[model samples]
Target: MKKKHNDHFLFYSESKTKNRITINGQEKQHAIAVLRVEDGEHIQITDGQGNLFVCEVESVLKSSIECNIVESWSVKRITPDVTIALGLTDRAHFESAIESLTALGVKKIIPVIFEHCRKPWWDKWRRYEERFKLKMISSMKQCLYPYIPELVYPTILKEVLEEDKTHMIVADPNGSTLKSEIRDKQTPVTCIIGPPGGFSATEISEFNRTKVVYVKLTPNRLRTELAATVLCAQIIGHTL
Candidate 1:
């Protein structure tokens, strides 16, 4: 098996060659200014596509940082792709959810504007999309994860329900245990977490109309962000 660098800071770069890689934008600035990475220093890097590169810093430029690849390998993606369809909530909570889910290796996140979600919050999602992305990238690097979770903003409950045929797991207080819902690791999952206020009657009715499994994460109420992270962890535990 290939060795893992658990302590080195992981940088992200899409521009890479067989034996070379370049870190640009905020990541470049971070390596230079914040991490103070210098020539001949080794750093771990990911392409955000399941590949990790252990590299030695070649030079630091005014615009970007260049590195020579010492070794590289691919990390397999987590099995049974997990997608989180979370209700749009307050900025801080929603962003927190993004970070938490990314660290758990969720494949994708869809921000749905459910009935309980405030219209103002939904409207602001687009403006904060970039910031949300940065949070995912930060979380991925912190956990030394190879891939950044995909983010889709400004959607609705109805749209998600009809998006695909994957198994849908809805987080509810009065629902059944998660163990019964997640049986097979090969089956893809789309876990839905409502806003902090919970899903409305109409939304519940919509769920009833379609096929979905309701799993209760806990008997007590949880904040929207916490509920989302819990659900992701449960799915991973059961499936793995």
Candidate 2:
């Protein structure tokens, strides 16, 4: 098996100023003992929020590695701000969703609960949190960007729809095609996706009541993971 964090490795280092950072804990051990990184070698680092730093390793101490920032820059976040809310039904597919969407520069992910959602889904979601966060860190590093996408889970569908400030979109095979023409330049957007079994008729009615713009990704229905990933990528493409 491939080693963990062989390339594009990233970790959380809180720096009030971006000029300096200390990599401690197991990460420090990985660099000093395992990676055997030498002084004067440059490496990448991030604050987990948009600021990326390229630094030269000044020294490797027993407890931590110290580095001096060589270059500092910020990546521009995507426009028509996007958040993804979905019901996760498959463990492997859900991990794929997180990996793909985060690399695409999505800012937020909300794991929502709906009427068609089964009890088994909840159990799987709870068990996957640790792995999910690790996947986020990996994706954050692989993408070579700074900001870590926010992951919110166990959120209720009704409560999410009730957010008045953010404009909403729903993924349904029945709705009209979504394109740049349908994009709203003014408000932040949140796209909602349902389970593989699909939401009930009453749930669709509630979506309409909440004024969600329904869009169809494909003529045929898609799995929840594919639907959410595709919709997020499409919106991000338009914004970029």
Query: Quick one: RMSD of model 1?
Result: 2.9
**Candidate 2 C-alpha lDDT tens digits along 98-130:** 887788777888887777777555555667787
lDDT of each: 0.86, 0.76
- The sequence of per-residue lDDT tens digits that candidate 1 reaches over residues 1-240 is 332334557999989988999999999988878887887778899988889888888888888889899888999888778999998788888888999999899999998888878746666556777788788899999898889888876788999999785699999888999988886888889999998778899999999999999888997899988999999998887777
Looking at model 2, the pairs that clash are none
Best by lDDT: 1
The worst-scoring run of ten residues by lDDT in candidate 1 lies at: 1-10
TM-score list, all predictions: 0.92, 0.84
Best by TM-score: 1
Compute the lDDT for candidate 1.
0.86
